[model samples]
Target chain A: MEERISLSHGSGGKQTNNLINDLFIKYFNNEIISEMNDSAQISLDGSKRIAVTTDSFVVNPIFFNGGDIGKLAVCGTVNDLAMSGAKPLYLTSAFIIEEGFEIEKLEMIVKSMADAAEEAKIQIVAGDTKVVEKGGVDGVFINTSGIGTIYENTNIKAYNAMAGDVVIVNGTLGDHGMTIMCQRSGIDIEGELKSDCAPLNSLVDSMLEVCSDIHVLRDATRGGVAAVLNEIAEMSKVSIELDESSIPISEEVKGSCELLGLDPLYIANEGKLCCFVSEAYANQVLEAMKKHSLGANAAIIGRVIEQVPQKVYLKTIIGGKRIVDMPSGQQLPRIC
Target chain B: MEERISLSHGSGGKQTNNLINDLFIKYFNNEIISEMNDSAQISLDGSKRIAVTTDSFVVNPIFFNGGDIGKLAVCGTVNDLAMSGAKPLYLTSAFIIEEGFEIEKLEMIVKSMADAAEEAKIQIVAGDTKVVEKGGVDGVFINTSGIGTIYENTNIKAYNAMAGDVVIVNGTLGDHGMTIMCQRSGIDIEGELKSDCAPLNSLVDSMLEVCSDIHVLRDATRGGVAAVLNEIAEMSKVSIELDESSIPISEEVKGSCELLGLDPLYIANEGKLCCFVSEAYANQVLEAMKKHSLGANAAIIGRVIEQVPQKVYLKTIIGGKRIVDMPSGQQLPRIC
Candidate 1:
């Protein structure tokens, strides 16, 4: 482990994994916490199951193309709960704002958060606000924690993926990462390149309505699709072979990533999700996902295979295959 | 409202109230959210009542004399839920670390958090870590959100206080604020002045066992006893008369406050709490509190008076009466 924390420690990549396992897990060792999943599943009175998740959004330029920090904070937490197949019920937001920030901007950000909450059918039940002196912090940081109720029959988890399952993503990738990068760098592309930041609870509900036998459901947030698939492969002890030609990528985001010499698979996507479902329900789930606006670009990208256990492979359009390794270092910091 | 946010906006005083009311409440106006109390009261399945709370700890110098930021974070959120008469069940922690912070220090902090959770009989179920660039933030800031189950037949809220209720505070006041101030300012006193940051759930449970009719329970944290009493007075539409000589204050804290020309009432505390109960149950609750180690100095400092509505009065030792107003501006920032 590094002696001092670096930007990579928060990258949701290999270094972040090391920090969690080497330090966080070492000290916070417990049954539920050690699962190391996106959310913690807890049972109430040995009858009801609930999922809880937390995330802190320190995205630079609090305001971005699709949404602001507040909107991103709510969606991030809600999506985490949805990934666990829980219906997000309540959210708590804690904001740490630097002194001298514009009150109008704060109001706008909060309004955006309220709007997002309404769309997701979740309530911002509790909140705390702290203001620090100028230069003590950046513009603002929002931490949101959500609670959701998981139904009785849903058996969704990262470790639940099986060898014969099919993989599907709800929408396009790299839109959020590239948009934030473009906004921060003050660069403009020929067409509008907005973030794909949205809540996925509705889409998850639509899919579960058609088929609740999904093995794995994960939102490709910090590390994009590659990271999520790689983690699923490792956790479920299965191999994933992705068809590159079937992966959905917007033209604007693709052009932005190509111009910057970045791989779209490694970029972040806020309002997207990838699911592993039984082969019998893959087409039905994909069709259901495509019915929703947020999942209009739904596509089947890959399938779980038994050849390379605990690994992910990308079968390129050029008839070549390469390992889709977990992201290594900080590709882009503060890209919530 | 001011054009830009100032340090006073987060002071947990009058300015903080203004910011919350004029902005946060204006847009997030809802029945439950408009209450604007420490924690929000929420119901699940229309049968089970729960309390959810969130707090962000930006206490400077992350390490302090009695407790570090990690301990403060857990105790802060736990106390919030305890104030709502809830048995805290789970907590989620999100840490935002500066780029160059030492890994050893973070480990120590996480260890502190775990120890505090164990003591409070809660689990640190889920967590998120985000590392910002160097100079982007102070050493570390932790945001903890807690979920607690509110037992039946316990009606406790800020507005539940009545005119004839008695006010009781467990332990001494202002220890946390003074200790942090002394540590940050490099001033050492002759005797020890440690922070009173502690979990008050056990004490609360003891009191509840003795008397479930406790009207209001609140921890005197940021703006201390004065801020809490004033808010209760306004919320319940009642007046309070406090005997200055009856309030508990340690000798060292009194001396420090005298030397610094600061009112002990306006200072912060972590382990202390104040409750409002009918005069009938005050003695029983006080006896129960005194039985616990955390409430050895529990005392009846005041009672709800009918002289003035929506006001608070302090009767001095010299037999003079004066108004105890809400704190106006930021006396101490980042004191947890």
Candidate 2:
């Protein structure tokens, strides 16, 4: 029953309340949010540790083929907190919306955000909205700040990637970036391939439950896998050897990357993660990941090692060795 | 000897360090920032209470008449924490710059940011940078998150505005917004009535040191006095009355308002504060403010009363009482 977004949508008026209650609250049905207060107040256990992370999304083409900016904003922040080995509990979303955008689209985006938050089990607590003239804004810009509770028993960081730790990926890389690219370019393939954009906390929870020794948990986003590996190497002061044959890539994704001159390693991914674990428990993490729909393509593609300090090397199918470097510049702009 | 901000400024390269060091660190001149890192770290006494506040500045034109976005970002966040009766300690600045911005301007902005932070006696701690395409971004946007250490006995909220509490203004309002407007409109004026964009932390600190009976503190921004008072009323669930003759308005500001057909009450102020204090200590706080250059015109303009719960009423110069209301729509777009 929502019409196109009028200026009142952000006016903190009837339209604002209606939009929040009818769509946002309806979809993101949760205890804390039901009150619709300025911020969500929840009790924090003194024994539980807390982690904070903030991320901004300037994704162009707010509404894309498979997903929209709202969904991306929620999933992106939630995933970041999850990768830090925290159970994301609260989020603050600040929106920079351009004037003259449609109301229906606003509702759709808000609904998507609510749905994503609901699925992720996080409360969209505090939010701020500022609008600029039509030309001054790029449709919508979102900054999501997440606060999560970290269990006292979990000690996770890039520095924990010890020698011989196995690198496990929850699913195929490039699915997210490629999907956005294809959709933006209006490419229609025989089989539909949308972005694998979902909350990865549950999948991450599974792995943590199975292997408490998970060393490094990283989401392959922005600079992607190569950048993540480089970060781990730099922090852990060790190298990683990735076997090209062991890495998993979908045929569609491989074809898309090959055609677009994109390296799958550098392409961003969502609803997927690159985790490191001790070789002894690598299989256990992989097994837990395979149990989740989002992690159906889980694989043990590499291992941390003592050779070549602070580097990542990949073996090629043709038996060639090449450095898998951290992405020097943005690979695909606005892919997330 | 700093070069301008170019694409290399955010390339995580040498240029970035030079800008941060030569301009930012130099102006900041803080021990913590002198040795540059991803974030500024500080060790605070565990016993001191802390106050946290975050704010984002997206002021347009990047450069305004008397200030820029960089300066505004730091002052705004620090002031928020200070208004909460805290002594600001550290700040985090995040920049979202558009590609192809001038490097020289970027350096100036960074220098301005550091200068403002230092002037406020707060250190720039953590930061982040993201770039959008030429079409996707404005010149730049800055977000500052600040944390302050609150003294054990300092606690002030709007709800504490008891009946007969005195309402005070740190200085004349409408200067900042008018300066921005004049510059944007290319209005030439003689004698240079500059924007009052100074940090109010020192004033707050001095007042808190002398007078611990302060009931409420607020920065009159966006909707200026109207917005801030309404916030206090709602939070305190109290009513307030303003004497028109007591409210300080600069002659130039009044002239500009008349010419522009704008209401001074609804204009924005970046450097001024609206405070409610117990009548006993109101004069003491006002005396402290008058010592600072920014608060030379500070005055006790109103008083709180237990009538018409949560409303602000103003007595016009013509001896008529009119209820003052917060502007439902934004009066100034992106005015920090």
Candidate 3:
């Protein structure tokens, strides 16, 4: 391991996983936490189960095209819990503000957070605010932790994917990562290149309403769909075969990624989700997802296959197959 | 509100309250959250209540005499939940680490957190890590959100203080704040000047075992004992009369504060907690607290008085009386 932390350690990629497994998991070893699930499920009163997840938003330029850091913070954590088949009910936000920040800007960011919470139908129940000296931090960073109730029939896990399951995605990939990249690098795009940072709790709820037996429901965030697919393959000990043509990729995002020589598969998406559902329920879930505003681009782009266990294979446009490994290095720092 | 946030806005004093009430409470207004208690109590499953709290630690130097940011983050959130008469069960930690930080230091900090959580009998169930570019942040900042089950027999609130209630502190004040101040300023002190940052759950549990009717419990962290008293007074609509002579202040902290022209009353103590109990159960609770290692310096410092509403008065050592208002204008920034 590197003696000093590098950008990749926070990239939500292979390096990040190694760091978490070697340090955090090794130190804070416990049954519930050690599982390393999207959210930890805890049983209360001997019966009811709740999901809890946390994420910190350090996106550069706090305010962006479609959503700001505040909205991203709320959506990120809420989506994590929702992906775990839980109905996000409460969220707690902690803000670390750099001293001398504009109070008006702070108010705007908070108002954005409130609006996001309202959209998700979740309450911001508790909060903490800390201000650091000038130059101590780059503007403000927000950390949100969410709590959601797990329904009775819901049993979603990364390892729940089966060989007969179908892989589905809720929307186009890489809009968030490309938008942040363009904003940071001062790239001028002809079209409207904005982030896809929307709350996906409603989308997930709608999908689950159609089929409760969804094997694996995971959000494609930090490391993007490639990383999520690799993780699901490894966790379920099944191979994932993705059809390149079937995957949804917005033209603007694809053009930007091509210009930047970046792979859209490994680029982060905020509002998108990757679902591994039973073959019988995949069409129904996709239909339900397409009915939602955020999931209009829903597509069943892949399927679980047992050809090679613990690997993701991308079927190319040229009819060749290649392994899709987890993202290794930091492609975009402070993107989320 | 000021145009730009000054250090005082995060001082956990009058200014901080105004920011929360005017911005956060105004935007994210909901009944439970709008109350702005230390922890928000949410009823789940129709009858079971759970307390949730979030706190972000931005203490300078990352590592201090008695504890580091990791330990402080865990202890702070756990203490908040405990103060709400809840048995803290789960916690989520989110780290915003500056890129190029030493991995060894990160490990040590995480180990410290694990130790603190173990001592408090709480599990850190989920976590998120984000790395910002160097100079984007000052080392590392931690935000912890805690979930605790409210005990059935307990009902503690800041506004629950009765006119005849007695206020008690678990130990001496100002050590944590003074220690950080000295460490940051490189002050050479004679005696050991370390933070009193420790888990107070066992101490609170002990006190509750003896008297479950404890009216209020709160940890004196950011703006210290005076700030806690002022909030309690305002919330409970009662005046508190403090016997200055009975308040415990360590000799080293006292000397340092005197040299710096600082007030011990306004200095934070991480491990120490202030409790308001029914007059009849004050002695029992104090005795129970005294038996605990963290509360060895337990003392009854003040009592609720009906003379003046929403105010705190101190009976000085020289037989003079003075108003102890909330410490304002950032007496100590990043002292948490």
Candidate 4:
């Protein structure tokens, strides 16, 4: 491990994993956390199960095109619970605001958080606010923790991916990451460039109704689809192959990524998820997902394979294959 | 409300309450949160109940005398759950770390957090880490959200205090606030003045075992015992009378507060808690509390009265009575 922490440590990629494995997992070692699905599953009353997850949003600009920090904070935790195949029930939000921040902006953020919670169909049942001296913190940071009830007979897990499962993504990738990047860089892009940030619990519920035997459900957030696939492959001890042409990408995001020399596959998306289901239920799940507004562009992007265990391969448009390695360092800091 | 958020808004005093009532409560209002209890109690599977609480620690100088940010984070959430008459089960920690922080320091903090969780008999099941630019955050700020199972027949709450209920405190006051204040001011006090930071779940369990009908249980933290009593009085719509001579205080802390011109009633404490119980079970509860190491200095300080609703009075040593008003503003910022 490095002697001092770096921006890469929070990039939600290789360095972040190293920090978790070396420090967090080493000390906070427990059966639940060791599994490290999107959320920790806990059994209550012998049979009932619940999912819990936490995330701290430090997005720069605080306000983006489509969503602000408050909305992102709510959607982030809600999506994590949804990724665990759970119906998000309640959320707790804690804010650390820098002293002298505008009360109007704070109210706006809080209002958006309430709005987002209502949209997610979850209640913000507990919250705390702390104000730090100016220069002690930048703007405001929100940490949200969510609780959800797991559906019976639903066994969604990263390690549950099988060799013959089909991989699907709800919508376009990298819109969120690129939107933040472009906004930060002051890059004037043609057409609309907005964050794909929204609550996925409802969309997840729709898909679960179609197929309760889904293998794995993961929201591709910080480290994006690439990181999620890598983790799933390693956890399930299977290989994943993605069809580059089949992955959904908005024209504006694709253009932005190309101009900025970034990979859409590894850029963050708040509303998008990578779903793994058996081939028999793949079409049915895709149809159900596409029915939701958040998943209108749902597509079959990849599949799990028996060959090359724990590896991820992408078949390019020209039919050449390339490895999609886990991101090593920070590409953009504070991009949520 | 102020145009800008001041340090007073997070001081856990009047300003803090104004901010909460005007903003957070106004927007995030719900049945559980509207109660304004230390933790929100949620029912699961009809009969079973659980408590949830969230707190963010931004103590300056990360490392304090008796505890650091990590231990405080864990204890803060665990104590909240305990205050709700629940057995803390799981905690989700989210860390916002500044760039270029020492990895060794983070490891030490994480280790202490793990140790605290083990001592509290709770598991740190899920966690998230986010890194901000060096100036974006001060050293490290930790937010911990906890879940606990409510004890059977437990009806503890802030508003449960009745007219004849007796009030008791577990230990000395202002140790934590004074420790941090002196540390920041570079005061070299003679005797030991460490923070009274410890997990009180075990102590609470013992007390609950002794008397299950405990009324109000609250940890005197950020705003100290005075703030807690004031809130309780208002929540329960009853008056409280504190016998000045009966309150427990360490000689060293008393001397330091005298030298600093700080009131022990308004100073923060990390481990101490205020208990309100019926007079019939007060002695048994005190005895149970005294049996625990953290509650060795337990004392019956006051009793609830119907003379004046929503008021708290302190009887002086010289036979004079004075109202202990809610603190108007910040006394010691970042004291925990």
- Residue-level lDDT tens digits of model 1 in A89-124: 989888899999999999999999999999999988
What are the TM values for chain B, all candidates?
A: 0.99, 0.84, 0.99, 0.98
Query: What is the number of backbone collisions in each predicted candidate, taken in the order shown?
Result: 0, 7, 0, 0
Task: Please identify which of the two predictions, 1 or 4, would achieve the higher DockQ against the true structure.
Answer: 4
lDDT of 3 by residue, A75-124 (tens): 99989998899999999988889899999999999999999999999999
Expressed as tens digits, the lDDT of each residue in A160-222 for candidate 2 is 789879999988887887888777787665466667788888888888898777778888876
Error of 1 at A203 (Å): 0.8
Poorly placed runs, candidate 4 (over 4 Å) = none
lDDT of 4 by residue, B90-207 (tens): 9999999999999999999999999999999999999999999889999999999999999999899898999779999998888999999988889989989899999999999999
Superposition error at B69 for model 2 (Å):
0.8
Which number leads on DockQ?
A: 4
i-RMS for every candidate (Å) is 0.8, 17.4, 0.7, 0.7
Candidate 1 has a TM-score of 0.99
Which candidate achieves the best lDDT against the true structure?
A: 4
Give the TM-score of chain A in candidate 2. 0.84
How much is the TM-score of the A chain of model 1?
A: 0.98
Model 2: lDDT to the true structure:
0.70
Q: What is the lDDT of candidate 1?
A: 0.91
